[model samples]
Target: MATYISKNLISGEEIVLTAKNHWLNFFSKDWLAYCLSSNEYVITNKRIVVKEGIISRRIVEINLSKIESVTVNQGVFGRLLGCGSFTIIGSGGTRETFRNIDNPVKIKRAFQELVS
Candidate 1:
């Protein structure tokens, strides 16, 4: 069976479809309550992007309730191929990013629509 999690952008609520493993990981990681935010389109997670001088190697975590807006990032390859990543802004000026998901444009759009 295949499972999916269409999380609520506002409440950090989620609906699981198939895979329970990742879903559990999301909770233990505090991904739902911490890194997500509601948007008219898609949710954004913080970018654990390797900064120039950050030296702590911890597992990336995100709060799904803090997202202020969803910003899509795409290169020529991403745009041409119809995929990309997103950035999210959250409460107290926090942020996150989820990279390289399938059909990001469509997913974001779906999320935006659903949330709306």
Candidate 2:
């Protein structure tokens, strides 16, 4: 399914990549947890954004220029299913992680290509 950005983007900021929360997010027996864990990651020309929350809303936006590194953590199960968690380190030592996302390698590559 295609996820569209809810907020207005910059004049030239175009979406380069998009990822939905992994199927594992829905594995919880608790329906509330499953619903709350649903999220989307969008990579644009200028930034990476994560939209998440349950009742109240939370949006995390990281400028591409401030990203110092991107790392993907793939465990045995993750590798087997081709899904992993991604960590992004920013210039000020700030960090964020997106768990159980798809095609982590491609996501990391997209970040590197956009930042450079």
TM-score of each: 0.44, 0.85
lDDT of model 2, residue 60: 87
lDDT of 2 by residue, 1-116 (tens): 44436455778899899887667767754345456544668889999988776665668899898889999999999999889989999998999987878778889999989877
- Evaluated with lDDT, which candidate comes out highest? 2
lDDT of 1 by residue, 23-79 (tens): 222344434422332111222342211111113322333344444565778888767
Angstrom error at residue 106, model 1: 2.0
lDDT, residue 40, candidate 1: 18
- Give the top-scoring candidate (TM-score): 2
Candidate 1, RMSD to the unseen true structure: 11.5
